[model samples]
Target: MIPLLASLLLVTTRPAVSQVILVEKAYEYVQKKEFGKAREAIDLAAANESTALDARTWYLRGYIYKELYKANPATGGELRAAALEYLGKSAQLDTSLAYRKDGQAVTRYLVVTFYNEASGDLNRQAFDKALTGFRNYLQARSGEPPDNAYATALYYAGYTSLLMGNQSGARQYYEQALRLNYRNSSLYSDLTSIYEAAGQDSLAAGTIRAGRQQFPGDTVLRITEINLLLSQKNYRRVEAIVEEYLALYPANVEVMLVAGTVYERISQGDSLSRESYFNKRKEIYRRVLSTYPDNFSANYNLGITLYNRAVDLIKAQQYDLDIVLLYEILEKVSGLFREAKPYVEKAYRLSPGNLNAMRALEGIYYNLNEKEKSRQIRATINEMK
Candidate 1:
């Protein structure tokens, strides 16, 4: 009877084996900074039926995995993801809020990781993964007030979505960022382009106008507004706006090109004022060439303009006029051709393969009585055929 009682006491005094013991072991290993061992113990605890539902088990597992990720970032994406999962589980299971605060703090850290990874993914052209990572960052930051960082993330999300060909999604993110006062000028420009591509011209115009209001000195926005007015055939408004832009940006080459084209377009319609506008067009092209001597458009346009005027003069010449008068007219036509020669020759040198320049050069040589050069150009044209 004594042996039986002793045996029974021994058995009763010993602790029963439970899955919670694994969780306790994990915590002990964590205290010693032995995260590898802690991870093994906590994973077992998390897999067991009894401790799997225990909040302490999940919290310890989350902490262990998070530590592993911190130790080895190069191989830690899966580890960090695991940590987030378990931490979320712990927060969900802990009705008493025992791990809620710590879980949230850890989540904020993980959110930074998500954002960093998203930026890397974006640089690598991993559009789908980048989009997901950005959303994860934003979701983690939900309920936060709109700030510069938040707005910047929104812009990135929109940019990523645009790269993914998700136009509607991009529009939503951009609009949200706009409401938060995102200060990037590209945000407005990109959104405007999207609206215009969707055939929402009014919205495009409104967005660009808003962008110009916000960034009054933005050259791109100014040019975009000019183009929009041109599209609407609002020539009067376009001229007024272009003159204002020129006064502000006197040496802006792009604006000068636009101004020259505008003058040419106006001359085509206003017959009574055609010569005046044509002179303005030529003057603008000359100004561009003075600054950018090698500008192809300026060289080609000026040369062609002079060439066409000479041809028109030749066609309108009066053969019935007196010989002296005819000689004067011939001199004027020859003078115009002489003025056109060097420009067309320079244009031909700039783009040797351009058939228009080649043909123009041939005509210029023929008109200048350079029979050999004209024949050589004609032979080359025939050879190309």
Candidate 2:
């Protein structure tokens, strides 16, 4: 009777001991490289309420799955998630030295995996995925010493978000990197774009100025700043900014182009003296042309500006003028057309088949009494397929 009763007690105790026994068996299976059985054993160990809170159970679970994740990150799926979660939990519980070491190793592998995935996504132009992957790498190794790749990762994270059309996300990630003192010139250039797109004109201007402070010789940011100021109709400030840059970088084609654009914007607005702004825009383009003789934009914009100025001047002449006076006014206006002709002609030479350049040349040649040239320009325009 006593022996039978003892056997019954042992049978009831089996369920109670099942959790740790399964966990130990999981370790055994892992040693034998039988991950399938290891997973089964760990799953059962975690399923039991009594073992659920035990540190060793979670540690063993983490260890088994960490190996699985490291085996193939792309195929890790729920196993990867399970490993990261239980490993994090084990570390949090201060399980043991072995558990902590395994957790760190898993995290290190995760860092490497995510970094590679981020770079791969970047190569494929899968920007949103790249951004997330880069961020995941940082999260994996939060307390580790940052390498040069840290800034590169952050910059790409921002760039990828920008590509995904998430301006706010780009700004957030870029700003984090900037705060960490990342020293790339494009950092400022890109941040300005985000701020400008968001309609934060002041912020955009500030970003450009800040970039200029860090990289004083970078005229791209300087031009962007001047353009932003122009958009706000800050004409004097635009003049000042452009002049400052020109003094520092004499005959710079890009800065000169931006300066011309600034005055062009000012000339179109009512706040400034249109005549002065018009002349300034012309002068700036002329300066650009002197350095870059075959520059298409300078020639085209200068021609357009002269044509518009003549139109404005002619319209301002009153109908009260006598026939001879009107004739004389038309003759004087023909001089403006003459001045604009060579610029439009040069633009046409630079871009042989450009439709806008062709159209502008036709108008200039027609107004200047070169009917044959005008006809030829129109024929070329018509030949465009």
Candidate 3:
């Protein structure tokens, strides 16, 4: 009875456990590499009203979680996230800057996880989650962002926003990337397209021009600029740009074809300049054929141009024209048809199954008064039907 009374008396006199003691115990567990127990101790300290507001307690909690995460990263996503949160809180609450450096140092270890997780979310087409991940990555930079990594994240954020159909959000992110001097050429073109879609033509043009200045050798931007100018009926500017491109890349058959096609379209409406443009188009096609003798497009295009010119002459014959003038025009038309025959025939040979090339040859033969050739081509065309 005396032992029981004495035990009760000792219990009554015992001091309460301190919250700081739990923190110290957590630190001791961490020193022994018993991260799980350290986490439990720190969590208890954090939940106590007395220690929950302490900056050092939060920092210790963050540090302990970080060790747990490092031990087993594959299953430590929650641990990693919690560590970041606690560390950030420590930074905010630590007015004396006592834990700021350590907190930031720990934060740097977790930064790449945010970006990696965000990239995975992007690839999974989970756009909303991906955006949130990127935002977290930016925040996790801990106030000292590496320029290249920072710009890359911003650019992709814009790209993901675009995929989500959030053009306004995309533009904001893209503009930020641009201001940071992000080196990707697509950034300029994308911004220009956005501006154009919003009916901001001046801004679109300015963006494209700025992109061209920054990436002068970029073929995509050059082509994009040419297309924009062409849409504005700015033919002279289009010509100047094309000629400049050709001067730099004379062997670039693709741009040469584009130039010739553009000239052909321009001649369709500008009668006063029709003959000159056609001649220019013919010269470009000739250059292409010179380098690529068996090229189907150049052969077909040159033949068609001559054939159409002959047809145009015939269409212009007036009812009351002088007989000598009429004979001269007929002679000239026959000469043009003869000139078109070999090219059309070669084009037909290059693409033996092309109906258009067969038809063009048929027309050329009929125009040149070659009845036997015309009959043979006509029979082949009928057989295909």
Candidate 4:
């Protein structure tokens, strides 16, 4: 009877002693940064029937494995796979543990860390690894509602699909991300590009419009929407929009330039006489020139306007009048040409084989009736060939 009692006592006390030892060794390994050793201790503690079934033991085991996987230099897929396995076990063993103040915080931190690491893989252009990591992060947070990080994960996943050239997948994921939160401006840009690439210009324009409504003051979206309208020849609407923006910020040069171009387009489409239309064009160009003297389009258009006026005078056989206007143009616009020369010459110097600058110089000389200068420019253009 005495021997039997002794055997039962030893069996009972053995587990208690093993549990204490296991806990101590695990903590010691963790303090020493020996994550592998710490994981081993936790694994041992989790194997014995008496200690293995405890929630804290399983939680510690999961935490140790998570740290180990994070510290490992393995690929994102490998790390995520291992982390998912451990976190899955912990979640299953104790769902309530996640809501425990400290437990919830720790679990959230782990989830976020895993997500970011996976995102880094995606950023490195490792699409497959990133996909796996994102999947693992979602699985680990199985019962949670969509949070900011969750939304961001969906966005990145869509972008990864784009990088892989999977258009259908990209659309699905981007839509999912947007459904969660349409306030993401950068995601709108991506969606716009995707639709534009797919030849869905109307859809792209609508997306930009929606983005503008959501982010009223976003200059980039406003500009893109305006450009799309201009491309579609929706000039009246663009004119109205530009007028609104000009009212808000009157001295904006870019807005003024676009407004001028829109006016020129409208004038071209009018059923007006050349004399009437030419006068209108001259007024618009003058307005742009007055406001932005150094603007290239303004200077170039002013030159064209002078040439046109001279042509009109010549058509009436008013030679003296035309010559006097031409001389006045040369004197008044000399500084514009001089300023433009450096830009034209830079292009020429950069690509001596290019004909763009040579052609421009030739046109300028021809209009001025400088035959020697025109001949030199023509030779340069020929040599570029």
C-alpha root-mean-square deviation, candidate 3: 7.2
Per-residue lDDT of candidate 3, residues 1-385 (tens digit): 5699899877764422567789899999989999889988999989987788889999999999888888887688899999988998888889999988888788877887778878999999999989987888877773775597888888988999999999999999899989888998989988888888898989999999999999999988888787777777788778888999999999888788879877977888689999999899889989999999899998888888889889999999999999999999999999888888888888999998889889989998888888899999999999999
Order of the predicted models by lDDT, top scorer first: 3, 1, 2, 4
TM-score of each: 0.71, 0.66, 0.64, 0.63
Ranked candidates, highest TM-score first: 1, 2, 3, 4
**Steric clash count of candidate 1:** 0
Best by lDDT: 3
lDDT per residue as tens, model 4, 1-385: 5699899998889877888689678978878888788878878887877776566666666566667666654644454455445555655667566524544555676677667878888878888878767766766776898877777778777778778888788788788889887467767777876787778998898888788888887766666677777777887798789779878876666666666666666655654645564565556555665777556655555455444445444344545567777667555455444434544454455555656556765665665567798899898777757
Q: How accurate is candidate 3 locally (lDDT)?
A: 0.87
User: What tens-digit string does per-residue lDDT give for candidate 2 at 33-90?
Assistant: 9888998998898989878877777877887887887787777856766877888777
Clash totals in order? 0, 0, 0, 0
After superposition, which runs of candidate 3 have C-alpha atoms over 4 Å from their true positions? 1-21, 31-34, 67-77, 120-129, 139-148, 252-261, 271-385
Candidate 4, superposed: residue stretches over 4 Å from native: 4-24, 31-34, 46-54, 69-81, 95-103, 118-142, 156-170, 189-193, 196-206, 251-343, 346-385
| TM-score-superior candidate, 2 or 3 | 2
Please list the C-alpha lDDT of all candidates, in the order they appear. Answer: 0.85, 0.82, 0.87, 0.68
